[model samples]
Target: MAKSTRGRVNAQGDGTSGLGMVVRFTPKARSEGVQQLEKGGFRVASSKDFRSAVAVPNDFDGADVQYFERFGIAIVRRDGERLKPMLQNAMQRKVISAARPERSYRALGGPQTMRLDLAQVGGVATSLDRDYLLGYRDAVNELVDRLLGKKGAEGLVARAAFDETSNTWGLQAIRAIEGDLSGAGIKVAVLDTGFDETHQDFVGRSVTKKLFATRSSEGDVHGHGTHCIGTACGPLRPTSGPRYGIAHEAEIYAGKVLGDDGFGTDRSVIAGMEWALDEGCHVISMSLGAATQFGDAPSDDYEQIGQVCLDAGTLVVAAAGNESSRPQQIAPVGSPANASTILGVGAVDRPFVPASFSCGGLNPGQEVDIAAPGVDIFSSLPDDKYDRWDGTSMATPHVAGVAALIAQSDPKFRGWALWARLIQLTKPLSSPARDVGKGLLQARGSGEV
Candidate 1:
């Protein structure tokens, strides 16, 4: 695991007391099967409209098995092990396809979530001195190592700021997007911690939010979701710092898969996926994932579901994970991202150098599909504010926003073609393929819609 950012993850109490178990049904889930399961004292609700996939009232009663009818999958919630056999029976009764316990997912970013530093997620109000010290220490260590020609430093220096302009350096690197394309017609769903409806820049925009995690509503308290949403779909002419959003004119789908604590379960994420698919979002951007040990295969359920998203004309992208600290160690791509069908994105600093903490394509079949600027990225925060942060979590949205742009440019770019076009347009980098897959992302010369 090489000091993985993804250690075992568990969900905060959703005012419920039980375990979350995921079950996939045969073909499309049948009404009789769902009704029968509901009758078994297992109430399920994850804002899923089995008919059209719209966000409805999904207030938790006891525990709702997060159901995704689009994929015939339902995350079963039951007290104790009482209904284990019934679930097993369903697999026999032709209602269930596959079943497994839900794994934990978290908002991936530079901040070691275990510490929960506000500045790490770009909260401008709370700046602790220790944050500076730690950042400096890591920066100095890597800088000196690179200077001394020791370790795997690669003679790279981490910059304090990527750009001095009013936009993020990531947007600067992919300057081609600023032309005519603004992702006006695309819909991007960011399934992470909830979003901040109070953010000033996003006011009056076409933003839709839904809570899959246990929370009062679709709001960001942990700050990761707001930051990620800002990078992916924030405003272009904001009343703030550099422009951070990619698909500035695109509709925003903020799915609160991870709770305010920045942690979520498979139940929340999968349920969110269902909701996004139902909403007909063109791109589903997930800057969240679970850790994976070496030799760990990607989740069968996630892999299948990712392919399903692609088959349905939506592209799913995820953080390759900030699990590895380079110069001495490297880690496998994380779960969900590690899944072959999902596009895994690694992180590079503003200098176009692979981040010391960015995981690589060490695991077979879990190769990093792309790389993007993730270091010291400045973006919107909750209280009409902005700050700089780091991690592959930041990189995932950059690619996702680009996907939306390419999707809007032409209809043919949907599904895997979008992936192919992106690969075709990347500017080659000197970094190893394992670190920067297909090179840095570049916007097409013309966004001819």
Candidate 2:
């Protein structure tokens, strides 16, 4: 086997002491045997057999197995390994990876579980073949190499943050944040699509939090939020060093407000903000923004809320909407972000060139704060993995994480003091005309800047 890139297992005490076992079933069989196995007192876990097309959570013990004409197979995950010998004898064997890693943080009030991953499921004969299974393993091996490969070839790292030679702007952002204060005791609240809580970069360090803004209590449904979180707080495991997030050791409060479709309501976002504040989070990073503009009354509501945040002393950083230009000229950014007091961020390329997708002066000639590398940034993904994706959404957290670092360096700064310090520390890039407010964000800055 090629060098296995194992995830950092949190092994303080006895590992695998948890009770949960996975079992595979035999290949296509004409008999209603699986049902008989279920009837014999076994619980059904999860099934990803493409042959059978049903994906839902239902209890299946003693009566869970059913044979369908569509695909003649019976597969199930049971509670214990009581029937391991029977299963090994009856079905062709394949490998299994833990579906869910043994999580360190449990829900406020929930059950402890160690879920198993169903890596592959096929005909027992073909699946059991050593070469065939090895071939499948090879594909996975390639994905891991791509995920961690520094040299640009077929890996996600190379795809997102490397050009043939060096790290891209997104990777640079990762470096900046990771450098000075990855260990700051700050929490960056990320509300986006779902994150892969199972990945190695996040291992024992991740702390899941609810986003009251989401319609459902589900975590990031889409992968966007997870990647962004990686930028803000991806844990540094052994194989991956210097790859840690800016606030690498900082606590992450994941709030999956965006659904699988990547669309969320303003109400949901507002709720997420409130939750973050309630938790006493000093810095909240919102890589999301509204595509449409708000009218006077709605705008006023936003300003009022922004002032509330100011009074309560939390920094709400939002993306300047990606939509830009003439016919569809979106005005003065969007709700929440457009609020006079809240910081509205626009994107600039690596060379300080404004991204075409980055919305321009909504409140022209006014202070736009600072700009950082935002085009394509590399960040953490679910599992022991990584990916490079683009969006001002990804960029916002770089600054927010920096805010966490600053707080860690000097804990006295809170509310307006923190916001003022950020603005005061910013190095102005644009002159009177083209670039309005500040240049890029500088971690070590002269208070006079």
Error of 2 at 306 (Å): 1.9
Give residue 39's lDDT in candidate 2 (0 to 100).
56
TM per prediction: 0.80, 0.57
Q: Which stretches of candidate 2 lie over 4 Å from their true place?
A: 1-180, 211-217, 236-244, 292-298, 325-331, 364-367, 431-436, 446-449
Deviation (Å) of 359 in candidate 2: 0.8
Mind giving the per-residue lDDT tens digits that candidate 2 earns over 225-255?
Answer: 7777776666544245345356677877776
Candidate 1 — which residues are off by over 4 angstroms?
A: 1-17, 28-64, 87-97, 110-163, 176-178, 446-449
Could you give candidate 1's per-residue lDDT for residues 78-99 as a string of tens digits?
5536556666666667676666
lDDT agreement with native, every candidate = 0.75, 0.50
- Model 1 sits at a Cα RMSD from the real structure of 6.9
